[model samples]
Target: MSKPVYLGKLTLFWCSSCKVPVLDGKCACGQKTEKMTITPPGDIRPAFPYDVNRINEVSRKQFGADMIRPDEIVLYNKAPYEDRMEEIICGGVILGTIRFETEKTEWVLMPRIEGARRICNTKTFTPEKMKSGELKNLIVLNDDAVPYVAEGTSVLVPGIYDVSDNISAEDEVIIITKKGEVVAAGRAKMSSEEMRNEPRGKAAKLRWKGTPADETSPEYRDDAESGFFSAPRTWDDVIAANRNILDTFERRSIDFIRNTAGNMDKRVTCSYSGGKDSLVTLCLTNKALDDFDILFSDTGLEFDETLENVRKVAEIYGKPFRTTSAGNAFWEGWEINGPPSVDNRWCNKMCKLTPITALIEDNYAENGCLTFIGQRKYESLARAKSERVWRSQAVPNQIGAAPIQDWTALHVWLYIFREKLPYNPLYEKGFDRIGCWLCPAASLADFMNLRITHPAYMAGLDEKLRPYAEDKGNPEEWIRYGFWRFGKLPPFMQHIAEAKGIITGNPAADAPAEKTGE
Candidate 1:
């Protein structure tokens, strides 16, 4: 069979020495000028000519009529569609018309329909540019330096020495500079620890370009000694830093609670997870407001320590703490629907949303209420894009306010410091989130930490997932995928890792565990 011939525009160079197309790997122009080739979609000239309407119908069925943008065009061969191209076509193609969203539009030469001829392609076009932003509140590294980063600066690898919290991909974030100037901001391509540890690749893809520092927005004004990066330390320093952090946190937290109470309706509560964020949020919320409720959604997959911690937090706060489970119904739901994917997360619906919705419906009983959340904009891009206060369309008549929406991870820790709030033991042991024992959002390092610190929890995860893996007829893929994801199998199950040891050490699979405890 003949090799598949790629039909496209061929460059012909008229060399004074050898007048011909630039063929045979040599240019006719004794000067040896290089030639380039370009191809457009859809074979204009084909041996097997099919109806144009059929192609249009298929394209429309697969992609919406607007699948291809007006600014773009499509390319195709005789073969079936390429998967990558299919995505691009659906997301980025148009017809022969090219539109320009930016200035500096220019004209270029396009190949004529036949005979290697060229014509002036009177088209104006622009490349796609995406923008994002983050807000940076001044955070003190020590007694010395106060740093400021703005809402829209690229977070490079070298800029960050330590992370403030357990942020995930696609979460909104606020960026502050080491010198106290808020830099540019955008969605994080990687997490906080991922930015600190990963040596290569673009750490956070900058959405909005930052304004340069000037007299109005000074650059690097903070004293070097005061900055936290000035003195990096091991686990032992956490206790010493507590005093400084707590002092600052207590005052701000009190203010935050008061402001939240004043701004929202009577019904407010904390989204308690027994982790550092929610714990701090609960303590601070209670301090500021009177008779606020705490809602704890038991995903039915929480670590034993997390459950205990919930009890402890509730007892200490002296507030009514409620528990709602995913129940057998959720388990049965998963059985019918199969596992949830990254985009399609029904678990959040079954476990997190349903319980909260039920509670609001039963307790509020048609009364208008407001809920306070511990969500910080720095947690993710989706969160960052959100407003500080918004009405929940899902839950009618309830307003949601994230009092600490603009705060950074470091700020949360500062609250823990000043108030001397009781935190989940897992934070000391290096677990960032203390929700479900096997949360899909955890990083690889988080999973491994679970293995070393909480082996029994790992065992539970393995047992729970085993049946699902078997039902899928690809037990190995299922086991290996979730194991390396967040919930680590116990050390005893190291053989499981060894048996199908093919997948490990991947950034997608694991990261270096953050050291929080001795």
Candidate 2:
């Protein structure tokens, strides 16, 4: 006879896909399904309820309230008695209360969220001066009761009697008995059904938490290299350095005007991409030099919204904006060679550099003119090498002045705040950098957020990229794996939904994956 299956307290019930808990008897997947609602076993300790307002305050303190929703709250709850572990059964928008001890000041549990397995402790989980011995005594693992687990072993496929409905591709989860005892901590290797069918390979990547509630930092990289660090310890230093940079820029600007102001004819132009840096450069130049031209080269792949923003800003400044379309030539080049990758960056050089060079050649003057740019030293390692004043080797006898070279991100934000400058709305929404929509340099989360926030933009990207990925092969994997599976919806979308008390039906609509053709 087959071994008796372990059915802990977790009850499987058919529910409406709309609300995973309210028994609707049918799932949107068209298959009958059952979900496990996490409930603690007898006398299981519970996390105390956290105030929603306190969460908002903490979020504001961590990440300013400039763009954050004022109503959003993030509360903390602790897993009840050390013996039983917490499991996140469902993943999506959820609202539930938790119970905890009132006297415990050091530990607060996050709101009871389905699929929000405790990934890491963020300062509040541990007791003051808590030790490992104290923690081991507090919690218990119901591994033996699960029957799917063996001591000193990895989580294999056959032992997984049941899987959580909300398992994501790379989400962290708790392995436990349906009775709510912690077995192991691990990352999900496959989705629920996939794990059941594919009875091979690893299922959950296991982890060991030595302390019951140790508030240790999560294992992740520093925010600086990841382009996620909006503020750093050296921000003040960077800000102080900006004074010298601004002075250098002002002096160079005057010199460029004095020398090239008369010589500048049709050839001299500010290359405008409608980016914050480029816009600042063109506006400054337009103010300083009369009849200076704004050169905008369209590569055919810019976002429609971005293009509109460009036009709106240009119209506002009342500057003469000249446009050069380079799509046909770029497509021709792609047909011959191939799509550009991050390492190649040939698309930028070929499509942008070639057209601008052609424009300069067509309008070359006897006296070489200057190109004022809003290039900043803090943009990347490449820009770090740039100076306040330097002559471009690409354009002989033409000088480039990067007035904002030494500015920090805070300075940029401050400048925009103080002057009420027009900027790409994308920046306000948390996109650190903006360029081609399909660029691979974008993080998976970034791509996911873009798709969820801007479905129309994603649709356009899909139409443009489908033929290309198909031509190269493994189109499905490219779409499913590279695009959808690992991608994440932007955090703000959920925040917005939470604030409005509405659920986002199509969270990944704006994803580049959705935009790209499979």
What's model 2's TM-score?
0.47
Lowest-sum lDDT 10-residue window in model 2: 41-50
- Return model 1's CA RMSD, one decimal: 26.7
* Predicted candidate 1 versus true structure: per-residue lDDT over 1-518, tens digit per residue: 33433322232222223322222234322345334232222221111112223233333321112112222122222121110111111111111111111111111111111100000000110111001112111111211211222333345555564343455665433343333332443456676567657885445554433332332323422311222011222212322323333444456767867886776546766778777777767777777777888877787767778888888888888877766776665566555544443324456667767776777777776665676777765445577678777888766666777766645444565456546777776665644346766556554445555667788876766776666556534345445445433234444234444555423221222222221100
Top TM-score hit: 2
Clashes of 1: 38
TM of each candidate vs. truth: 0.46, 0.47
Give residue 254's lDDT in candidate 1 (0 to 100).
Answer: 70
C-alpha displacement of 62 in model 1, angstroms?
51
Model 2 regions more than 4 Å off: 1-268, 286-291, 395-397, 453-457, 460-475, 480-518
Model 1 misses residue 275 by how many Å?
A: 1.6
